[model samples]
Target: MQIYLPIAEMSVNLFLLVGLGGIVGVLSGMFGVGGGFLMTPLLFFIGIPPAIAVASEANQILGASTSGAIAHFKRRTVDVKMGLLLVLGGVVGSAFGVELFGILKNLGQLELIIKICYVFFLGIIGLLMFVESIRALRDIKKNKKRLKKRHHSWMQGLPLKMRFRASNLYISSIPALVIGFFVGILAAIMGVGGGFIMVPAMIYILGMPTKVVVGTSLFQIIFVTGTTTFLHASKNFSVDIVLATLLLIGGVVGAQIGTRLGLRLQSEQLRILLAILVLSMCFKIALELFVAPQEIYLLLRRI
Candidate 1:
């Protein structure tokens, strides 16, 4: 299949890209993730250049997150202060990450390094989320009441407390900033949108309600990804705006459907399923790193 794209004149199959985008969009809508994690990998799997994949993912994330954030905002589900703090930290972290990427690229082990980190982090996150959700589910079943509000302690006692009216949260801003910084760096390094890590961090470490976590994370992602897009375009000129727009069309529609599906699932069920999917992918990727592939070499000699 040959398609003429506005950004690049290359013969490519249009259906594949759009289909991949649709799948990613569904996941994004369901989880409130930027979906770059899936999109970037899928692009690579389909033979796109790594640099192009990374740049395009950033651009696509900007659009998808912008749309998703708008939806979240309409629901009054975004924590603006927290999102901004995270974005600030994320930007700084992304700078460091970009430097690290350059260093690793020179070392010629960037791919291995990235894969190892992805697998390790993804596995840990998935397992923890899965276990937590299972417990939450059991509680919901045993007691027909919602989980009790956890009392804030040491975290809230820290200095430099800031109030977030939207989330009704009064906590130390430093913690969020620190968390965002690390998340941003990872996102930049791995070419992911960082929602996977950010969502968990916000809910567990930051003690934000899960209901608002997705929207707030999307808000931060827009800034983080937008910054990433600018950085790539300015330095590499790898940003494929047309490819991004194509993906965005599919992503936007998929997100709406996924969002509706998410509404039907119990919170615990959704978390557990998401956790399992994440962990399984992590394990699969990790196995590729640690396990050797079967050899199928053939040698022929004629005398």
Candidate 2:
């Protein structure tokens, strides 16, 4: 069935949109990532304007993340204090990102910048996760002795330490704030929930336990993506509510299923799967960069 996207000024297959949403939603649930990274690119592949794709994907992410967050909260896994702190930074960062996005759009560099950012970040994060997960799996298979936890690190020495009872750690809020800030900027710019980066940062950089990382990341993603959605709607007028609704319908349900499946998988296995998915996306985007395009120039309607 065909559906019109008023904001995008185009028609698309309804089932295709829903199927894309479902696929991304499953990933969102499984990895606590918003799936926007995957969905936005698919939107581009489907011929949606990049701006429209990014903005609308943010709205869709809000719905998926909400569902995932609720599931995590019901399990009492979310870290409320940590999530709030991250949200605080995320809000500020998103504002900056939106402003930069506007400038890039006006200069006609927004799409290029988005693609480059995706390639760089995804490649780095994917490789790291893949290696780490493989090592973790190996250690598990060999029944290696657990190493002692290192309490002292550069982050621990930083000032303004705060306790995160749910995460069971006392660390400087500064690192958390910084992490959230960057993630928020990326979230707005890339139409992603920033979980792909946030999850690893929480695990490796902030020393957060794996159990709480997914839930906490989702909690922050909800507000971050919601803010981006509203900003895109108001500033760029690019958010397609109709498109978002269809995607959300499939995404929300997929997320629920994914979350349940995630619970059944081992942490190492989950990380490996997520790593592979990220790398695949990175490879696809990179290939597009090298391949020649069918259209060299395009017409744009006057604003």
Candidate 3:
């Protein structure tokens, strides 16, 4: 059966829509990402308008992240101190991003700009994660006894340093704030929970453990995406509740399954898989732009 998205002004297969959500929900649970970076692009390729895809995705992520975060919280992998700092920055960034999205929409550059941002960020982050994960795997395979060591980073010199017991590190609040802010902006513009960006940043830059970062990233995504959803609904009226609801029905269940499966895998394995997924999404979306147009979608507005 097909369902009409009032806001998107298109009909999509109900099963396909829910199935996409389920797939993304699994990734969200396993990787501690909201799966927006992946889902939004998929929606675009499937004939949804870029603006509608972005706004509706934010709504769906709110539901999916909430479900996934609960599982992480139960495991005690969340760093509250770090999460709070990220949230503080996210609020301000989300507000600014909503405005920017509206401005771009008016200028008729929303689709192009959104695709460019996705290609650029996904390529960089995915490549970095893939390389790092491969090295980590090699060390494990070689029976290398990796000592727990904290090396000095320039970010450590920043002011307002604080200790996070959960991740077993002391880092400056500045880095988290900056990362959170950037993630928030991406969340609003890209309809992502910023997990794709935040997860890697937490691991490499903030030096947070992978386990802790996943839960913390989810927590931060919930708040930032909530703000993004409200702003898009109020300002752009682009959110399709019907579409979000269908997606959430499958997403809520898939998340729990993902969390359980994730616990069985090594951190390096998780990172490598996520890296490949991100890269795959980037390439797929990039191809959409160069390919000749083969489908037509009509968008209607309420009079």
Candidate 4:
């Protein structure tokens, strides 16, 4: 069935949209990402406008991450204080990012900008993860215990520091705020939950325990994505409710299935798989920028 998206002003296949959502959701559950990193591009590939994809994906993330956050809260794994601090910075960043998005849209540079951002970030992140995971995998094969290297102590040290009992850290609020703010901008611009970046920063940069990092990232993401969604809907009017609903249905189910599958896979394997996926996406998007379309041949004949 085909459905018209009023906001996006496009007609797309209903089942296709649902299937895309499920695929991204499965990746999200298995990899602990917001899926926006993958989903937003998938939307573009399927003919959705970049602005529409970003806005509607935010709504999908808000729905998908909600249950995860709630489950973490119930389990007492969420660091509420740190999460709130992240939210505080994310709100401001979200508002600013929305404004930037609008300006880029009006300037007719939105699609190019979004794709370039994806290509650049995904390439760098994917390469790093792939290298790191490969080493870990090799160590496992050799039955060698991985050495625990100390993390970088380069975290910021601004004033107004507080203790987070859940994370068991006595750090300055500056680092968390900064991380949240940067991610908020990405969320508004990239339509991601920002967990892919947020989780790593928490564990390695902020020195937060791995136990609480996922839950804390999800908790902050809920509010950040919510703010971004509202801004996109009100300012750009790009959010497609029907599209978001379809994605939600598929994402919820896919997540459950992915979680079960993830448990059966080794962590190193999963990281390597995800890294390959990300790099593949990055290369594909990069090709779009350089590859000439078939129509170019017809235009060249005139020359």
Candidate 5:
């Protein structure tokens, strides 16, 4: 059935929206990532206005993340203290990101900027994850033992050190704060939960345990995306509540399924799968940048 998105001023297939949510929700559950990286691009491909897509995706992420985080909490895999610190930084970053988004939209470069950011970040993250996963898998195959815990690095020497007992690390909060800030900015600008970036950063940069990383990332994403949703609704007025509602219904269920599946898979395998998905998205967006458009100019109606 077709449904009207009042804010977007468009009609779309209801099933299609639900399906998209389901797909992203599965990813969100499986990787403990919000799945916005995948959803936002799909929205663009389907002709949703960039601003509307970003704003609505943020709202959708809030629901998906909440479901996934609760599941992780039950497993006792979340680092609550760490997640809160990240949220502190994310809030500040999101505020700046919203203002910047408004400026870019006014300049008529929002879509291009969003696409460019997607391609750039996805390419870097995908390559890193792919290479790391391969090495990890190879070591496992060779029966080589891996370190149970990461050693102290430069990051550990930084100021504001705090103990994250769940992850069993004494690390500086500054790094975590910085990471959250950047992820929040990306989340606001790109309409993602920032899980893809946060997951990897938590793993390699902070040396957080794989078991806890996804849950912690999801916890922070909830607040960041929630803040973005409100800002977009009040400031940009681009959020389509009807669209977000449809997506949430499907996404919530999909996330539950994905979370269960994640428990059965090896960490390396999950990272590899996520990397492939990221690279695929990066390629798609990059291709659009080089490909010629069917129409060189768009005609807008005058009020």
Candidate 6:
């Protein structure tokens, strides 16, 4: 359990932290998420403070995402224009979110409130995605030929026409910017990387191909999370760099494995599995919200 740091004269629970990181990394790589949603909660369950959990996870995502983004960039899958717009929104949104966080911190019930909100959104989004994916699968099964007629969506005809060669989509810049802003605020406040929401938004809303979605999403995450980490470090000093490094190590390796597996997967199958996973997490969070925790003792624990 003891992990000695080379620079710092301190030891940590390396096994547990790395193991948790490994699980989160695999899930993140496979699901195309930053794993902050999972990492923050896991950190809390293992006794790390919420503030520290958020900051550390942000730092970890910075490294994990940077590496992933490089790989994606090398494959020529990143939409640079789209990524920049999202990052611009994300920067502004995170500032607002920080102010909101300050207000909520004074309220003292923010943890419970945030959990409730997380469960609600996760459930709603998950169910919607699941149903849609199922319907799409049925349609594909019924008539696979329907997919052959590749017609551009009406979104492509919207104003502020912009071309994304990597994603091979010509879409409206305004709409994409709006979506990015909305997702960025959520990412900042919830301490999530916004990949779960952003990827879907790009695929379903912006009508990008699934093949390029993951890479571009990771591309955006690098900047979003890196900025987040810097902000937390300079302002809050909450980032634990050592912790982030351990997580990044696990995440990078897991991502490579997941990328390979993702290539072998059928689009429908991947969608269905991802849908199920999202729904399962949604149900689990809801259960936690509805079910009361068991208090074993009248113990007052301090973080």
Task: Output the number of the TM-score-best candidate.
Answer: 4
Q: Which regions of candidate 2 fall more than 4 Å away from where they truly are? A: 145-152, 260-277, 301-303
How well is each residue in 26-81 modelled by candidate 3, as lDDT tens digits? Answer: 77667655677778888887898888899889998888878668878998889988
- What's the true lDDT of residue 16 in model 6? 78
Rank the models by TM-score, top first.
Answer: 4, 2, 5, 3, 1, 6
Give the runs in model 4 whose Cα sits over 4 Å from its true position: 145-157, 292-303
Which pairs of residues collide in model 1? none
RMSD of model 2, in Å? 2.6
Better of 5 and 6 by lDDT: 5
**Reference-based TM-score, model 4:** 0.92
Where model 6 places Cα greater than 4 Å from the true spot, the runs are 3-12, 132-172, 209-212, 262-277, 292-303
Instruction: State the RMSD for candidate 3.
Output: 3.5
Question: For model 5, what is the error of residue 140's alpha carbon versus the real structure, in angstroms, after optimal superposition?
Answer: 4.4
Candidate 5 lDDT over residue span 188-279, tens digit each: 89999888788778987889999999889988999999998999888888889998899989888888788788889776788898899889
User: Ten consecutive residues with minimal summed lDDT in candidate 2?
Assistant: 145-154
Instruction: List the pairs of residues colliding in candidate 5.
Output: none
> In terms of lDDT, which candidate is stronger, 3 or 6?
3
Between candidates 3 and 5, which one is better according to lDDT? 5
Best by lDDT: 4
RMSD of 1: 5.8
Kindly report which residue pairs in candidate 6 clash with one another.
none
Which candidate order results from sorting by lDDT in descending order? Answer: 4, 5, 2, 3, 1, 6
lDDT of each: 0.76, 0.85, 0.84, 0.87, 0.86, 0.70
Q: Number of clashing residue pairs in every model?
A: 0, 0, 0, 0, 0, 0
Off by over 4 Å in 1: 3-12, 144-153, 156-158, 209-211, 264-276, 293-303
For model 2, what is the error of residue 232's alpha carbon versus the real structure, in angstroms, after optimal superposition? 1.2
Give the Å shift of residue 137 in candidate 6: 5.7
Worst 10-residue stretch by lDDT in candidate 5? 294-303
